[model samples]
Target: MSKMYLELAKRNLQRAKVRSLLAVIGILIGVMAVSAIGIFGESLKAAVLQNFEDVANELIVSPNFQEGYKYLDEKDISRIKKLPNVAEAIPIKSDSLLVESKKKKSYAVVYAMDEKDVEDMFKAEKGSIRLKSSCVVGKRLAEFADIRVNSKITIAGREFRVAAILEDTGARFDINPNSAIILSPEDFEKVSDVGYTMLIVKAESLEKVDDVKKEIEEKINSRDEKVVVFDLKIILERINEAFSQINTFLMAIASVSLLVAGVSILNIMLMSTIERTKEIGIMRAIGAYRSTILRIFLMEALILGLIGSAIGSVLSIAGGYAIDLMILQDASYVFRLSTLLYISLGFSIGVMVSVLSGLYPAWKASRLEPIEALRYE
Candidate 1:
């Protein structure tokens, strides 16, 4: 009996193929938008977290004073390095500047830090990191500017030799090395002021990271120039929280289209109810139970939702890949396990919205009296 009702529901949809197709297209667009945005957001966050994975056991300290802000100077660096469980405290001076090659000019992040620390964070893809008036360019930056070892690039009107090309590391905590130019402290001071942006302190062991972080904060707080401390763990947590809020906001915006699709489903179902009133009257007169009538109408709705969601799920994969390629510029960032979950979720939500929208039409169809329905023109 259930199979008979299912067959009737499918036949009803086939009778008005154009209307069914329009409804499916609406839900498909809604699900595609939602799943695409979700995949992009998750991929971006994954890239960021992956960049920070190397420095997970380190803490970053920078001045947070309101009026008289002081940079993390030699004394502060020394103080941090001397603390128990502390291994290395490296000061990094970073800024955004325009760099130009013979090809073109592009804005890039410039990092001037200790040569040894730079070597620890990045490796040379082409040449060696020699301490001089030379700089190392990241893989993407080098590719973009057509730079290589022995190439001369201009930074703030000063020309410097490209000593090495660093391997790509994706997006890091605050900067992307793949899009940055790096310099030693000697070369950095020649172009810009002698002030460190932040200090990266490595704890002796992973277990001592918390202990070293607490001690560093205490030391910085006791000084007149207070500084903020952020361990990599804390930074990851904050990044996750921030992205969660952003993802939720974007998903909400995408859901507006789904709501529109729901309205489309509602209108179609109501039209279907009106068209089938006489058929319903015949069924009622033939001793079909009211519950059976309700179930049949509801089954029609479920069928519509199921078909729409299935098509939407397949379209979302192509849509997600296109978005990643256009926005992230990284083809390697395809669908992950989390992406599959997002697709499944979008399909489920689309089906639920469709079924809910059909409820009123189903109820109205079920409540029609046989005499009144049959008397209709």
Candidate 2:
């Protein structure tokens, strides 16, 4: 009996091919918009988070110039190291100097730190960090200056060997190592007398980052706000929260299309009900129940929804991949579980809207008086 009703529903939809096709197209656009937008947002967030993954457990402490502090000193470094949950406090001195390599000259940011700290913070893409009379150059600096390992470079009139080239560290708040040079403290003093500029503190563990930051703020800024503690973990959390809100806003905007599709479904179902009135009257007069009539009409809507949502969900993968490539320069996030969940959400919403839109039309068709329906033109 259910099979017979489904067959009837299918046949009825086939009778008005153009109307059915329009309805399906409407649903397809709606679902594709929602799912593709969702996937794009997730991919963007994932790309941003990946850049911060390695540095999230670290904190950057620099002097607050507004408080009359010029630079972070040995005292500040000492205070930070003594704080609870602090693993390592690396003092950094930075200055800009003219660099000459292979007859090419450029100004590059120079950092002065211990060899151990350099080993802990950065990895060499080309050579090792010895930092005796030699220095490590960032990848960008090496490329721009045309310097390589064992190559002699002149910095501030003092000659030094380029011992290593650091790997590119993309988008960092603490230090941009990709366009700078690192030298030992003894070598740094030969060119500039600038004191420590900042301290990079590593927390004992990820969970202890907040505690370490708070302790540094309280202890170091006890008299006045001498230094500012920047917790990368907190920044990461805020970034994730911001992306989540943006994703919700984007999904809401996309849902407007689905609402329009729902209205189209309602109009199509109502017109279908009116056109099939006499046919329904005959069936009712013979033996069909109101519930049976209702199910048949709903089955039509269900079929339309299923067909549209399935196609939309499949197409959304390609849509999402294109969006990710254009914006993030990568499309790997489209296959993530979180992205697929969004596609499923769009599919479910499409089917639900279709069924809901058909409810009133199906009810009206079921309640029609057989005599009146039969007399209608």
Candidate 3:
């Protein structure tokens, strides 16, 4: 009986070769788009999360500011260091500046800190910072600036010798490797004369985040008059809220395509059943069960779905590769196992939808009167 069903499905598929091919192609394209999107989104999230973790262990502390920009003074850093469960706290007087060299120049966001902190931020590729009058440049900056080792560079109206060039790590930053320069906060002070602007705190563990944050807030508020530590969870929630909107938009668009596909499946299956009425009638006459007829049509539709979705998955992978090359050529971004799970889930759902779509047509096919079907054909 299964063999008979397969034979009928193959014949039916062959009868409308172009239509079947096109339907499968449509489904394949849709599935592939979804798969590629899943890979890209997951990879992006992981990269950003790693970047955040690199800044500190779990939580970060910055002054509560209305403009989303502010720095913790040196005194504030000293106090946060005293908090329990603290690991290592680093202070950076960071700001952006347009840097120029004899070769070329681009605007750079520069972080000013002690030489030790600056050294840890990047590996020197060309030369070493002399600590007194030399500056470290990012790899991209060195090539873009067209500067060689021991070259002179100027930033924020100050001159410094090029101590070292950093390896390109594809990270956006204010110098160690990217378009950034790391100098002593004291030296940065003489150039810009701006007050301390940022402090990066590294906590010991996840469990201590809230406790450390609360301690710092209470301690700072008690000592100062109006300063307050704004809640960080609120910020994360807001970011999630934005992503939710994006998720909704993508789902809605996918739904439109799915609905069209559903309608197409229903129409095609119903027509096939109408044409195969005599075959169904012959089976019924031979004592074949109605359930068997239904199964045949459902299986046919399921096969079509699987074929289409497989095509889509292939398309998606190719598209994903192209996008990865454009955006993160050097970065490691691959389809996650979860993406395969998602594809499996998608494939299963398509098969189920195809089966469901043929239900009425299949039932009608099974219920046809053998005498009437034979007389008409």
RMSD of each: 6.3, 3.2, 5.3
Model 3 TM-score relative to the real fold? 0.70
Put down candidate 1 lDDT per residue, 1-377, tens digits, no spaces. 99999998889989999998888888888888888788788887887677777787788888775736667756877888899998888788888887999997988889887788778888888899765788989998899889989989998778999999988776665446788888888888777775888888888877799999889878867756467787877787898999978987888899899899899989999999899899999999899888888888788778877887888888888887888788888745555898888889889988998889888998898899999889876
Q: Per-residue lDDT for 1-377 in model 2, tens only? A: 88998899999999999999999999999999999999999998998898888788899999999989989868778878888888888889999999899868988999998999889878999999989999999998888878899999999999999999999987788888899999999999998999889999999988999889889888889889999888898889999999999998999999899888889989999999899999989988998899989999999999999998989888888899999999888899998999789999999999999999999999999998888889989
C-alpha-based local distance difference test score of model 1: 0.83
TM value for model 1: 0.70
Lowest lDDT 10-mer window, candidate 3?
Answer: 225-234
Q: Which candidate tops lDDT?
A: 2
Clashes of each: 0, 0, 8
- Cα lDDT of all candidates, in order? 0.83, 0.91, 0.67
Q: Candidate 3, residue 183: CA error in Å?
A: 3.6
Quote the lDDT for 320 in model 1: 76
* Candidate ordering by TM-score (highest first): 2, 3, 1
Q: Which stretches of candidate 3 lie over 4 Å from their true place?
A: 1-22, 41-53, 56-76, 93-112, 122-126, 133-162, 165-182, 185-196, 205-211, 222-260, 285-289, 326-332, 367-371
Pairs of residues at least 3 apart in sequence or in different chains that clash in candidate 3:
28-308, 28-312, 32-312, 71-197, 138-177, 174-180, 175-180, 175-181
Model 1 segments beyond 4 Å from truth?
48-57, 62-88, 91-115, 124-126, 131-198, 203-211, 218-228, 232-242
